[model samples]
Target chain A: MEHKAYLDMELLRFTTAGSVDDGKSTLIGRLLFDTKSIFEDQMEAVKRSSEKKGIQHIDLSLLTDGLKDEREQGITIDVAYRYFATPKRKFIIADTPGHVQYIRNMVTGASTANLALILVDARNGLTEQTYRHSYIASLLQIKHVIVCINKMDLVDYSEERFDDIVRDYKDFAAKLDIHDIRFIPISALHGDNVVHRSEKMEWYDGPTLIYLLETIHIASDENHIDCRFAVQTVIRPHSEDYHDFRGYAGRILGGIFRKGDEVMILPSGFTSTIKAIQTFDGELEEAFAPLSVTIELNDDIDISRGDMIVRVNNKPEVTQDVDIMVCWLNNNPMQLGHKYILRHTTREVRAMVKEIVYKIDINTMQRQEGEKQFAARDIGRIRLRTTAPVFTDPYRVNKHTGSLILIDEVTNETVAAGMIV
Target chain B: MSHYYLNHLKELEAESIYVIREVFAQFQNPAILFSGGKDSIVLTHLARKAFFPAKIPFPLVHIDTGHNFPETMEYRDWLVDALGAKLIVGSVQDSIDKGRVREETGLNASRNVLQTTTLLDTIEQYKLDCCMGGARRDEEKARAKERFFSHRDEFGQWDPKNQRPELWHLFNGRKNMGEHFRVFPISNWTEMDVWQYILHDNIPLPQLYFAHERDVIERNGTLLAVSEFLNMRGDEIVHNKTVRFRTCGDLPITGAIESTASTLEEIIFEVAASRQTERGNRADDKRSETAMEDRKKQGYF
Candidate 1:
């Protein structure tokens, strides 16, 4: 493809999770290297480090292990984002560790991803880490899941081993809420089925990892059935020309909005017609999900930040009581009846934990009931009652409108990530 | 034709504009950190678009190391005048004269590290609550983990391990008094994306970004431009070479690359075909593997 066409390509943000031995970093490095994303200086530095460490082959993992302690210990401690591009799409890989202790990091990385790349070793088949990562991805409502059966070279490129792993994964994934799951056999170490079609895997007639990433159907990942627009801020130019213009600026969360469409503002229950959808360039005739534009109403209604605009027929639930599956992020344990700040969409309100319903054991897929307190990296279902009404949808329907974060009042640190149930 | 969705560049621009506008609404005092580089220039352009018909509501802060390229200074002045925006200059030389920071000595000495003290001082002096930067995550390894709304403590130290979880378009810029946030509007953009956006928007940049003939000395495999800030070695010889800078920084630390791309199209093509990262020419990042991380923890933009 030409450079101009490449510039017009779409973007796909994905997250990769695997155990330390599953060659996750090697897979990412191979993708970058084969796609010509690895620059000459970076390659040279990796080579020098490999020589200094007395390694025979260049350690591709060093490219991703960026921190000093991580490089010294040869482990990725936190989430690291890597960017690369192909002629078809631009890719952002949120590399997260697969260890159980870093579940919060995994959740943090997977929260914004459209797809999840879960790596499973061919020799080991599926381990507890695989189940944990897959469960987390499902819980995060990642629409697409690509299971890369890696280290095929270690298994002598055997078709039976590959089939067994796929079968095992399918059996385990049946318990997951994920719908779209695809399997690709790859040997990240030997550059097989990563960027290029593998000649060794004759039995596997699937697309390469790069091909799948580039051509996946992601346009429909967003919810187009419900119309939701959360007002981020009111844009009053206060200038001579646009003095009376009160534009509600925000990104469309769901469905499509056009000029002259009748919309309703949430929490206030006021109805108005969209006079215009404006941008810096000009007025847009219509806008859809993920497009940040300003909407001017025909009537001068009471609208401000933290308000939501939606279709009258398809309005989200507005209530002070919210049931959510919360992922604790900070070291401070979440106490019942503890008041915290709840930031949902563009709205901020004080919320207190009314109850801790249960905590899920990600590895075993079992719920531990009657859990009183929650610590960092713990995932549990809880009931929260906010001081004001918050409009939200279930995470299964729309990831953008369904998620919120809990911040500590004193520290102002994001303590927990919640997915509305 | 009426399109329902935005292209990649348009989407990136829209996201950046949203973030910039959010900074205006969320923080009491915010400023754009302008270094006259392409990224900052693009950021300033986005800030203009974010509030059209109305002037940019904040000032442009430039931490001058007193070793900047002359073209950068000229461009910075022109941009501030064109936008009708306020300009705040933080000088490392002044910091040195005030005994707030000491200048480095020897051959590899640079004012790059001293700019941190000056920057923090400027923030404190101006009482700027949030400083918007043009730092892209794709620039360096340490930057790859940066949050869009990065929080700094009372002393302006960054705690990478304890960063808040940034989710979707909702950014938490809430912080205590004396603590500030370093918000990166273009955190998701890469080097190629920046150049592509510049070309797409017809954004004017400093002349140093394009190919030009300059007297440079090759040291440590990088071509360092000869200037007053650089101390020449006994054996090092200056030679006129056709080179262009991939990044703009202090005159001594920022290296130039051999290139013949004179136009934006040619520059974009060259960037696409180039084998080295954009920061490969930066001497500050080459000091150690974690140089950017360490400097960033100490409040380096």
Candidate 2:
């Protein structure tokens, strides 16, 4: 066992999407195993289960198929989160099954990922799943995409095959809205180029998967250009000691917020300067995206929850109508003109779908016009008419302010995940 | 560029505090399920920070199986008073006395399974719509797929397949009458992360966590504290050993590790070197492969 000063380590969240035999689960298990994240008992349990199933070797995939049903079915049924850490960074892996409502599961995993690991079987080159996962990764605006061409052992560790696959993927990705694409060739089962560089593929001189994960610059991933704050709640100590204190509490959605910044209260159009950035550890001079803090204002504008605090000059658009790329998550098709609860950045609004512009064929990256109702696992473009104006930005700008979820009023289920166009 | 971004611990704390505040805002009656364990204690500390300069709005709910470590109860009460927060206790002994639950008999008997009925009853009777638990996903297999805002039915059952899809920072907390939610703010944290956070934040913990000489009996290679709650049989003898509990479940079935690590730093070092899962010691989990999942399906925390 090894030790390090883990207090100041950076956290990187990544998602892995692959078909059943693409070795996705093996990659995850290998990472956890090599990083010493897997405990002895867990390995023992998996080993026993694998032996019972008459497997020749320790089945790494058995470790991740968490549910009893998932194990019985020998497949991953939903997205399961796995954790591992190196000395440099702590990694959170959102492992999504590549089949069975793949779109919904991928979106759920991709929602919070800074990077996406799209696994491709070297023997199978690029399958429909590769294109689909790549497309969704692009749609979700993930900052980095690492296409791991797994099972290179089966391809005789041929550099030419890896080159062909990479070139084909590069050509296909040109059509998708993706940036910062890197390709790695390795065998997850053999522990090659996943945690350590493999000597077998000496021709491939790229950094190992672990090296890329550790060194990738993610500080610039946040939307630091525009300042946006969505108030989750208001804190009031009602005590006699701090009678007049009113602090707006929320997570910073985008950009940097500092003290003495001239800010405007959204919808209310009230202008005030930030009196202070309050936290339990004491006052901070500034806070940025993803950091939760309480902000004190110069004036009490009767602000409650769902309010936005932004710079007076740089403001998110306040709109009653939004164009969104919605992935329907419910079996019940989205009803036409039916009121659904639209929750975006802490604000809840009554919204109804007005039009389905087009539905996407994830495999071919083509859009079909004149689509009727949005059904389960359907990815498409739709227009939402909200009863109240929502302060928003494009999904590519700031994820917190850019994304929304629609809840079916009758079932009270999260029916769809939407991204602002 | 790096100065603006928070380190991982501070960021995790911030995220948890945000969730604590969200639970306060989203539910009419929310409570924290305090087990006097390190995880729950850390949760309480975060909640206090979430509403600093003001008392925690939600009452700390402890489900007592009557098989407790004396130090745990003492620490629980002391923490409640120190924070000036409300405490609500749901006792399994009371439930057993009232015939709501049957106490298991014989050597393997424990109130661990019966706590579910009392927990549900407490929730219903008190009308607690949301209960914040300090359960981390990395702790168990079934927990890895748990949602931060887990929906429970009117009958206090979880429908794993029908769980709502949680995306981004937006969580759907909508539910019908009689239904409630179990919110796990620290779902992303691992056990190592918890210890590191506790050490980094200088959070106070019960003395039982640090090594101390105590009477214990070894059963199936696990050390059990020799307390009044344990059902000792004929070949089992008690002896004093330096032991500390990694987790604070009910004292009867919760296993302890023999160690001389007396400080947080030492405990962390031991934890790093430990090969077994923390819950690997719990007799309830040792009963079957899917014991925890089965308990969870029946609304066990």
Candidate 3:
């Protein structure tokens, strides 16, 4: 048996964005293939596809195209996820399309990503599509950004061209709300500076893309100050062996959970003590953020689905009226004063849009007021009135418990993504 | 004896539990699709942990093809009695007897494709709004792009390309009167993670997973167990070999592999070092390149 070493770290998700023919697929393909994370059958499928296309060479870009129609059209039209792992960390790649008309697809992909991989062609410099992708990535609160200057092979791997493009990108990215920005020169077609160092660029001095992905410090990405746990289901064996096990099953939204702690259940206002935390293997003394475990309480209360369990001292905002920034996702336009289903955490209630305060322009970042009508893929601010009081945190406070979705009652489709402001 | 963190495995389990709860909160009538396989068994156990002190909210629905292994039937019955949940069995034999479906007769005859007809009929009769499945994305190419709450049309058909956009933790489970959702809680788990979690969790499985002496014959580099449903060819010779199943299915199609691993720990180690996939031995999948995709399009869970 081989000895496996464990590296403790947090999880980081990122999405790749660019225009058509900007080599976004090739760049991602190089990262997965170079890491030796591509499965055998996946590789075989790519090989057979490339052969059918009669390219006479293995096209690495075929790896991310999961659908048959996408392969036949030679483009990525939807958001697909690809997973890989190194000895240091695990990676989840949100491979999104790079077309202008599919801006909604980019938003859906970058919604949960911690970083963004913005590809740039060295010869073409920066296009309007590049700016749009970067702008949306910034709007989604992605803190880390990597601007990969690709196609250095066509320019004879010139250092001057690489520096020229990096300067142009910096000037545009400075206007956005971006903090951490890095540049790397690479030829994704030739596999340079992606996983291995390229000798052609003698003046380039930096770690390869694979090295950065494996060594980037992302341990403190989660908010651990506030404690929140939404009750999913109440566990009860009701058998002879174990009868008095009243456990609250849910994922810890934030903070830490330890034995002998005081807790409160929402809507019911019942308090109890945390007796033990149990997994499948055994009981643990403590559990933390993002880990799901069954929590046994000292006292059994009237807690069910759509109820929240939190620390007594720390509580979320409980209100029926909320101001939210919503992005419309359906083709039909938004109808004012219309009621729909608003699902937050584990609770669902009927909600109506009271007023549309304003809509944000994606190109200029300006607010359009008094324009209440919104089409598909529209981002705007609105006030919502629900039937019942819901507990929620700000979007910045916690991503899991703060966000929600709006569904059309008639069409039964997810009409929008809403974030509590 | 020591401090350890199964980071990936724990994350997968947490994600699955979250999805299970989402189904319970969103849908009105829900049930689990249990086949007595490893994945379904793991799902049943997770449902048990999801609601402690209270019973599992939903029942277990099995679309039996009437060609299952004996061990699987015994395990399924025992689990149902222990959990005290209702078990609904939709038989392919019943469907065939009533002219709901026809049994194919040829060299490559199989009941795998016919299971879809029985499954859809069962869903329509029960009026189940959501059916939780144990399908994993890592097992097949068609399943790789599936969402947590997969939507089915009025005819119980799955459209692979035009799926609804699923983002963040918000799952949309709204549908019309006839449509339903097929939710997969463990869509992100792989074969290796499933094995490790089973070992760590101490989940009981069928005896066919372990090594035993069985009369089998070699066909297309795979060992097929000799049973009543399977007809032996002239050139094929039967012999006794120590074999175990990678995936549990019907008696005629699912093939077993030669192995010496008899314990859970040994099976985990053997799975970790193997290069071939776990579904490589499925004779049903070897029928055509798009066999699974076609079956899925016709509403096979």
| TM-score of the second chain for every model | 0.99, 0.98, 0.96
The alpha-carbon lDDT assigned to residue B49 of candidate 1 equals 80
The numbered model that scores best in TM-score is: 2
Per-candidate interface DockQ score: 0.63, 0.75, 0.39
User: What is the Å distance of residue A331 in model 1 from its true position?
Assistant: 1.9
Candidate 1 per-residue lDDT, tens place, A280-327, comes to: 788988888888788999999989889999998899999899999999
Which digits, one per residue and each the tens of the lDDT, describe model 1 over residues B118-170? 99999999999999999998999889889889999999999887788887677
**A1-421: candidate 2 lDDT, tens digit per residue:** 3444677788899999875588888888889998888999899989998889998889888888778888888888778898888888888899997874767888999999999999999998998888889988999999899999999999999999999999999999999888899999999999999988899999999999999999998978888779998888888999998798898988898989989999999999999999999988899898898888889999878888999999999999999999999999989987567789999998999998898899998888789998778889989899989999999999998898999999988778999999999
Could you list the CA RMSD of all candidates, in the order they appear?
1.6, 1.1, 3.3
TM-score of chain A of each: 0.98, 0.98, 0.92
State how far residue B75 of model 3 sits from its true place (Å). Answer: 3.3
Residue range A139-229, candidate 3, lDDT tens digits: 6667788888899999899999988898888888878877888899999988899988999997999878877777665544555767888
Report the Cα lDDT for residue A240, model 2: 91
Model 1 misplaced regions, further than 4 Å? B1-4
lDDT of 2 by residue, B1-301 (tens): 7676766787788789878888888899999999999999989988888886677888999999999888999999999999888999999999999999999999889999999999999999899999999999888888998999999999888877677899997888898999999999999998988999888888999999999999999999899988788889889988899999999898888889999999988998999889999988889888887788888889999
TM-score of chain A of 3: 0.92
True contacts kept of 3: 0.37
Q: Which pairs of residues collide in model 1?
A: none
Chain B of candidate 2 achieves a TM-score of: 0.98
